[model samples]
Target: MSASLEKGIHALKEQVDSTVAAFFSSCVHCGMCADACLFYTETGEPERMPINKVEPLRRIWKSEYTLLGRIGKLFGLTKKVDDKLLTEWETLVYDSCTLCGRCSMVCPVGNDIALMIRKTREGMAVAGHAPEGLIGATTRAITIGSPMGVKLPALQAQIRHVEESTGKTIPVDVEGAEYMLLLSSMEIMNFPEFIEAVSKIFDRAGVSWTISTEAFEATNSGIQIGVSDLAAELVQRIVDAAEKLKVKTVISPECGHAYMAIRWEGPNLVGKPFSFKVRHILEVLNELREQGKLEISSRETQKLTYHDPCQISRRGGVINEPRSLLDMVADNFVEMPDTGKMNWCCGAGGGVSSNERADEIRLKVFQRKKEQLDAIKPDAIVSACSNCRLNLEDALEEYNMDIPLLSLTEMLADHLAD
Candidate 1:
């Protein structure tokens, strides 16, 4: 066996804990997960089924962890997990599966199919089978401290612009701030308006918040590419910065996976609890609203619907906060069928947007989102996650649909009482 293959096998072996063994053994081979997956639903491809994507992991578990399978392996009767198998599964594991957790939600036996897929990616990555795009992102995250390679100077430039335009000082590296804000690289690069919006709202609400120049980037490519050690390294940077500044809360910006990385997975990856608390921007905004700190002078008259970013809403337990915030600003708000935790994924989440090889498939599976919008026929779609917003914009443009996408934070900021 090649060195890479040996390492991959070893890694896969390590991933087969009691939970994985239980999940694999308890699976009823039900087709529920297949139907829950948009890639499978859109294309009717059997390989796109969520449970099937982890076939390599399942094989490893059986061959290594089961007595009957171990005997079969000794006789060369069991299927071996090799380079050929990993190569074939690269597309299934990375391109087709979004790690959105929708399949996990629908599993009859309560299996976390998404988690298995993520674990399977651990082996795939170590085996040198991860997509070129994800590999590039992981490298940039390690070397530049931002997956998109955003530097402190770029953020400083954006801060200068927001402050100059709005006449509000955007604090950075301020010690003892009540909250330390984090921004996804997408917000830093593709949507600086989010930063402007946060500045305006925080200023109006009298909220004490600061950004950290030391660890401003929120999205973790290490989590995306299934490198726990690297993911831990990235999370530790934020924890260290937060502790150093003595901030009470770290606000995860409107980036879904960033919130999941920092708020949900950060503690486990770092092997300790964070010194400061973590909250999604929506949760923070909602808290401000309940405190009567957010005074909205106007409301959206045009019909609006909210798209729940899979990570931020379904997986993160942040469903109601966005809806509450939207209610404050949108008079004509509507719900797409299966909204909130049960909502369909944007098809570009969980690093699918980063893989160029998945672009065609990504847009193709966007039919699921298109159908959701078509049912509601809203004039615009409001969402919190910047990555989801960008992907929605791309898919909407490709479909020749002229519906506009709006940021909930920006909407609240725009309607703040003058």
Candidate 2:
């Protein structure tokens, strides 16, 4: 075996704990997950099935862990995972699957297929089978401390712009602040208005929050590329920065995977509980609204619908918070066919947006989102995740749909009550 393939098989072997064993054993091959997957639904290809995409992982479990398969291995009757298999499945694993957790939500036999895909990616990454886009992102995440290669100076410049526009001093490295806010590089580079929006909302609500110069990047490419060590290193940056600043909470901005990385998976990846708490910005904003601190001067009149980022809604358990926050600022809010936790992915999450090779397939599978929007026919769409917003914008332009895309935070900021 080639060294990379050997390392990948060993990595796959290491991932087969009791949970994985149960998940593999419990799968009934009922095709429920296939139907749940948007790639399969849009493309009508069996290879895109969520369960089939992780076939390599399942093979490893059977050949090494099961009694009958152990006998087959002894007789050289088992199918071995090789570099060829990894290369072939790289597209299926990395390019097609979005890790959106929708398949996990709809598994009839309760198989968490999306989780298994992630486990499969751990082996794929070790085998050097990850996509060029994701590999580049993971590398930049470790080396440059931002997947998009954003630097602290860029963030400082953006903060200065926001500060000057809002006439509110943007706090940085402020010790003992109630919250340390983190931003995705997309927001830093592509959507600086999100930073401005947060400033306006926090100023109006009198919330104690500061940006950390040491660790402000919210998104974790490590998690996307399935490198736990790299992911742990990235998470530790935020944990250390938060503890050093003695902040009460680390607020994950409008980035879905970032919230999942830092808030849901960070503690486990680091093998320890956090010294402080972590919450999504929506959760924090909803709390402030409930406390009567967040108010809107006027409600949005145009018809608006929410696009629930899969990580934030399904994976992160932040379903109702966005809707409740919208209630404060949108009088004509509408729901898509499958809103909230069950909403469809934007076809660009889970590092798919970063993978240029997957761009065509990404836009192709965007038909699912197009159908969702056609059902509601809203004047605009509101979403809490920047990654989703960018993807939605691109897809909307491709489909020649003129509907506007709005950030929920920016909307609230625009209507902040006096």
TM-score of each: 0.98, 0.99
How well is each residue in 60-131 modelled by candidate 1, as lDDT tens digits?
A: 999999999999999999988999999999999999988899998989998999999999998999999999
* Model 1 residue pairs with clashes: none
Model 2: per-residue lDDT, tens digit, 211-247?
9999999999999999889999999999999999999
What TM-score would candidate 1 get against the native? 0.98
TM-score of 2: 0.99
Q: lDDT (CA) for every model shown?
A: 0.93, 0.92
RMSD of every candidate to native, in Å, equals: 1.0, 0.8
What lDDT does candidate 2 reach at residue 274? 95
Q: Summing lDDT over every window of 10 consecutive residues in candidate 2, give the lowest-scoring window.
A: 105-114
Error at 338, model 1, angstroms? 1.4
